[model samples]
Target: MKIHMTRILTLMLAVFLVIPAFASAAPTTKGSAADLRSALGNLLGEHAILAINTMQKGYDGKADFADAAGALNANTDELSQAIASVYGDEAGKSFNTIWSSHIGYFVDYVKATGAKDNVAKQKAVDNLEIYRLAQAKFFATANPNLNEQELAEGLKMHINELLKAFNSYVAKDYASVYTTEREAYAHMLMTGDALADGIVKQFPTMFTGDIMNNPASDLRQTLGQILGEHASAAVFAMQKGIDGAPDFDQAAAVLTMNTNDLSNAIASIYGADAGKAFNPLWSSHIGYFVDYVKATATKDNTAKQKAVANLEKYRLAQAKFFATANPNLSEQQLADGLKMHINELLKAFDSYVAKDYKTAYTAEREAYAHMFMTGDALSEGIVKQFPAKFETTTPTVPTSPQVSTVTMQLGSKTIHVNNNKMMMDVAPFIKNGSTFIPVRFLAEGIGAKVKYDKTTNTTWIMAGDDKLAFWIGQDTMQLNGMNKKVGATVFVKDGRTEVPLRFITELLGWNVAWGKDKATIIMTKAMAPASAAAHNMATDMTNMSAGHMSH
Candidate 1:
């Protein structure tokens, strides 16, 4: 599938990458964890997509099904080889055999659906159940980390999801088809990640870092997944539109899902207003691309040129949006990358229109892969812009009082205080560029006394020697009787009075850290700075030394 840039998809990558802030406790390493997991995801996701297209074509008795099936088989081989490369040639061959069985069963089901043979379909389903057991066993035998029953259950879900999409397609429920198709594709990515995790554990020396907790690496992987899906969705939608295919509306609707996901992603990182503003600009290029497709289909050169010109405007607009949002991002690099994304998408579509299927497919792959580069470049810029957000320092710093970390998800009712978990009526939320958590959490979790005075519309908190007072909708808060302006005003949300997290915590000589991963707040309690703690220790030692001398 060609890239839409996938227009907003580039933005989508930027949006999704900002999520998963607590991917791992380990530092982001491209070598073992990120690269391997992403590589597997790429191949597995591609396989699921190709299989869907191929099966659909086969059901329709389309000639291109052969080539599409070949692509799917190639992916299967690559996956086997990846396993073999880690284990041995025999292992690879065994994986191929077990994997091939599942694909064969799916093909049988497709053929049965085409022939209107319910019995054949049931037989195919039965065969898939057997294939699931074998596939699960193969993986379980390969690694102790992978549970057989769990693998079997996951495989069943995979089988059922694909069948559901195919059945929906057969029934002409295009919306459900695309929706389930997306779920199936995502499921494959999870499968790839699971395999990577087991392999990484099996050979710890071969991999450098953990996969689940590295926020930066998760950013890279998630960006690639979202952007790659965008490319495929755009390609499918554009093709349907150009062909006047019955599923065009459904395909386009799925594309809209991508747009919303991207917009929400942007909102999660940038802000609600930024995401709202970003959606229209980000979606404009897509409409422009549709114009290009419409023009191309009608052989209207002038209209096509106009569409291309508009895309150029979109490219600049997209670059500017990111640049304006983040000065750390390089406009030149973004524009160049977006230009390549646009060109490859256009090239793929043009090739498909000319009946040059090979060229079209090749260009589609390029467009999909290019988004990974975009993700990498954008993630680097964002990481540079917000280093504190990604920093996860363990082994708390030395202070007179031990530092205790509190981890809170943006909208979750649960909060993690050091090793303990507590649930609150209200969750943390971002307001005016700061996170706000419930005041009661400070008292219950961190051994602080907090009170809300309904008459005065004020709240007070005392953590050790630190005392802080703030008023609702107020910009200034009194810290130890001295008022200080904060990034956000204290306010009431969801029937709870919320204070600016950093302003209140950091004021008490504590540290506040949150994530690009959906605004996860990690506040550390530090009663005294290390310098003050050291000075106190030295003074006490000197007094003791003087007393010894006097004695």
Candidate 2:
């Protein structure tokens, strides 16, 4: 298969180079901007997600590790194909070799973690650093528009982000692991866009106008990203949900966050009321899917049918909701699209339940890729509806914050994190004389990592080197993994877990304060602490070994 791929890449390069002016050979460019950007973003983002997922599976010695890794290799080949198409056969060859080497290094890191071999892990890291330079240099040498230094820095960040997520996973810093992993995924989109830009610049006649400079295209690709993420998160959540997997809650949390992003985007474009109404409409479908999975687990056909009926209702309602918001979007077309989504998800889930993993994997990819089409359609309608907001305007990239602060008013459904308004399904309320609300997002805001284990109904928080864990309905919290007496027990409300806001925040290295009115709580993360080293220390190291350890 590898040799066959090589020959195919060589052929692609020959065709690209041999045709200098193939007016008879070049493709048309009507929506080339959106096409190229979405294509690159899709493949590159998948690479990040698959790589990290493969690494975790490898580390865990999961039964599906082989399947995950195989999927990752398939992605690598596709990426190389993209490179080959742009940079010709030789660059593609070099990219595959270097890229494969880095993935091998990551594999080695995971293996070393299993063996508790710190030296081997460091060796992997050192090899990765060398691969980083080679990768950047290769790209720079291939495309004059791409800078060697800047490319190297981006490569370095990529390496650091992937490693940091891996190490955080090892240290059980689940919140930051997801956060860093997501940042890593987002970082790859930037890389893809840069790569796409360089290619379009070098071969303008082939690719047409600047895809990199269009805001409308940006909206399209951004929507593709989050929408694809929603598909992925939903699939994984279903898989975990059926298995009662340890990370099931985390998977669900990911789905919820994706919903928040989609809803927020809706709010930004349509109106707050539309976004607000959209949440339950969106969440209802998720719940129905959950029901489907549960029914399938018990072989309850009637329950499964009922779940399907609920989803059908959701599909029609959601379609109308969008059509009502903008005339450019047709209710029938949207209903058709929603039907496709539902079928794809059900197929993926059903395949997995039957242990047909190969089909399940393919179906999952199909579902995910379909969302890009959905995004393209939705973005087109939106851009058409509000040309003044999207077509001519450039969206600014958000900069990293200097300080992160969050405020919550007692008995309110809204919270402000870094001055950004976030609405929760459940409102903050007094329980046992303590203000109670969800802290997963809040703790994450203050540079803390949060993890929820579904099996035990426990939530864990990590900051710098400090750790705290508590089980639902338990009065004792574990400080640094040891049981400590805490008078408060977290309780689940409205299908969301609520914790004592002040206690949980303080435990995760945040300073808590009450406003003069005594109804508002403010949480701020202050001072400097060692973040999970992006360079990453040996995660599996134990006992007394100072030969290669760093704090």
Candidate 3:
């Protein structure tokens, strides 16, 4: 098992990057104690997410943490930076030390598990206990008149649950691991609730002074609901992964249920309609998975073929769902999003099938973790789109932005181009909306077979010798030979010809994605010759033999 550089880098990058913290303050002139509390609480929630995400990734066989773990660390760093921004350098240093230690304990657990040493494990656990005490102490000191005992108790429960989750993974009892992880998550909600309660109780006037009466403060309830639902979803995904259940419905149920949580969070920040739109679209994903699993189980090639045919149906419905949810989003943007979600699920399932324990873990980490980011993006987009209902209500801090555009990074240059361009530039073609270049391009680019169709003006892009053909035309596409319409109207924009950006890249057998309104076309060139003498390649980019994309 050779771990490709892309996957390794992806794993590493996923665990390290931090997301910007968004702690809503009163639309007032000065920073109040309530603002500080909100910031700190938000930071804590963010850290909790990161630490757990990282630990899960370690179990998955990627880096020491999941990609979300990186987001978590980034969150902690942001918190420290935020404190420094408002407080001072001293406060930042203090925050960093306390925060980093908790992350350290998680790393220690990883190190112990890697070494398979009990003494080291116990030492790590003991250190975490100490760290936990100090962690609570630090928070108490920051907000002195705070309930130190209650905070400590909450911290203890959090640490214990995390420890139990990790230890169960070490013990290879995945079911127990997921269960404990859920409880740990549930504990976080309780702690968050307690903290919110304390805030209301202390100031009396802060929470509209009717703190006692408003036990279900929208802020507290919203946070609790968001966090609790996320935890449950994470646990469910983990449980399914570990259970090795072949039932797609069960796995999809876990994903679908979580999507509901995500939808509610979005609704809280957006509105009812936006949330409602998310349901069928969200459910459709489960439907696709269910279809795929059923096809996979029958061991019938015909069934598998039919199941895959549903990919287009799934993609369109899913894409429409996003468009309906956020009308402002461009068709291209929505299409890219749909592909990303599709890729994540497929890659995740592939890892499971391959028994790539490490990759499986990474997929599990993603399944459990990425929703917050999704919720956040949808919420933010909606917040910008609509204002009144969510004026005072803060958006649940979202995870990192979803990979929005596809890019192609080969050697030194990270190129920006659509999937169609990449496919046609490297391969031969009909030169209409389907930019045809050369068959050798697929072979050179990512080892997919490129066959021509003189009779029908089609090009068949196949992964290996599989019957699957990525069929393309001027106006339509048949991925593995099923007619499917694309989001972007496939047309020749220039003489070179242009196809729907994502379609061509994916057809070329590359992992295509959208990030920050850009395209990311990642292709693992497994067999390209190292020496020029071994392979001759001199195709003019300006004018290939294939029909050109006449503007």
TM-score of 3: 0.44
Off by over 4 Å in 3: 1-46, 56-72, 113-117, 189-281, 287-551
- The local distance difference test score of model 3 is 0.45
Error of 3 at 456 (Å): 68
Question: How well is each residue in 374-408 modelled by candidate 3, as lDDT tens digits?
Answer: 43344345444543322432113332212222234
| Residues forming the 10-long window of minimal summed lDDT in candidate 3 | 542-551
Question: Which should have the higher lDDT, number 2 or number 3?
Answer: 2
Supply the TM-score for candidate 2.
0.66
lDDT of 1 by residue, 1-551 (tens): 53322232222322222232334343343445666777777778777777787788789886556766776776777777677666678998999998988888999999999889999999999999999989988898888767665567568767887888899999999988987777677667767767777777677765554564445555566567667777877876787788898888988887677776666556656777997998898788889889999999899999999999999999998998999889888888788888988898898888878877777766776677677667667665665666554443333445245666778887899888777888888987754334577877755565656788899888876555555677898755654443344434578877677875643442332444445573576666533343344332222222211101000
Q: Residue pairs in steric clash, candidate 2?
A: none
After TM-score superposition, the amount by which residue 222's alpha carbon in candidate 2 deviates from its true location, in angstroms, is: 1.2
State the lDDT of candidate 2 residue by residue for 1-551, as single tens digits.
Answer: 22332223224443443344332122122254446667777877777877887898788887667877777787787777767776667777788998999999999999999999999999999999899889988887888766665566567767887888889888877777776665666667767767776666677766544554344666676677778777877887898788876767766887777677677667656667887999899999999999999999899999999999999999999999999999989999999999999998999899888877766766777777788778878888876776544432211322332345678887887888776788877877865334677866565654556788899998876655555667788655554333332424567787676776534542332445557675776765432222432111111110001000000
Segments in model 2 whose C-alpha atoms lie over 4 Å from true places = 1-30, 207-209, 393-551
Please give the lDDT score at residue 328 for candidate 1. 81
